[model samples]
Target: MEQMQIDPENLISIDFENGPYSKTIRTFRPDVYTEDGTYYALLGPDKATGILGSGAGPDEALLDWDKQLAVFISQKHSPDDPVAEFVFDTLGTSKKDVG
Candidate 1:
């Protein structure tokens, strides 16, 4: 079996904008090697509490992470609120999809 690895050099911070809100996201870079050739983007200390996204490549992983963030933000408001509706429309995913 192959082992998964992560490189400290891959750590990154990104400026994300959704609607009128702008925020920065810090990332724990995906494993350098994986059994399924998937890259996972992670935030927070562990999967249980962290936001996570996976894809075939790093960019896709990051985009998924952004969508996850949008879902997180939308949860703070009523579904019909403009901010909630805007993020759902822009990011296009639900909490289940992100987790």
Candidate 2:
């Protein structure tokens, strides 16, 4: 598995993995929102290239969501490099709370 971190100031760090060599790509801008003093991370893969937002503080829920996404992609698409597009369409369109 590969890993990557995106440091975009206010946004939470996005750690992602594609395979053994492909690191999680970071976006320049992240979409962020606060709810009940908790921040949530949102990634608009279609609109933005990388992270859309990060939940406030340490968001286990969001992290889990991301992990699930990675797992799903790995299991469903395996060695595909462009799995992000499929993930974005499948998960992003559903607008389901990953966390």
Candidate 3:
């Protein structure tokens, strides 16, 4: 199972037509993989609070994932928490950076 490890900022949006409307969707970090030539994009854990998309390739999987993300958000569901905080109570050398 190969994983995507690029910076999240490089992700792009995919445009598609829905009925008589046009839409664009962009997704954040999603677990991407392929099984028997089918590509899948998954966010979070389960269907209740997560989104899953599949396609013939990586980009297509991401595009589908983005579309699903939009739908989930429209229903007032969040796939992942966006808030974060870290208390710096002491001065120390850090070997890694967050965000």
- Candidate 2, lDDT over the whole model: 0.40
- Flag regions of model 3 displaced more than 4 Å: 1-27, 47-49, 77-99
lDDT of 1: 0.48
Q: What is the C-alpha RMSD of each candidate to the true structure, in Å?
A: 11.0, 11.1, 12.0
Against the true structure, whose TM-score is highest? 3
The lDDT ranking, best first, is 1, 3, 2
How far is 93's C-alpha from truth in model 2 (Å)? Answer: 20
Which window of ten consecutive residues has the lowest lDDT sum in model 2? 20-29
* TM-score-superior candidate, 2 or 3: 3
Candidate 1 worst ten-residue window by lDDT: 26-35
TM-score of model number 3:
0.47
> Which lDDT tens digits does candidate 3 get at residues 31-93?
666666777776554423456777887677877876775565444322233211111111131
Best by lDDT: 1
Return the candidate ranking by TM-score, descending: 3, 1, 2
| Candidate 2 wrongly placed segments (more than 4 Å) | 1-30, 45-62, 75-99
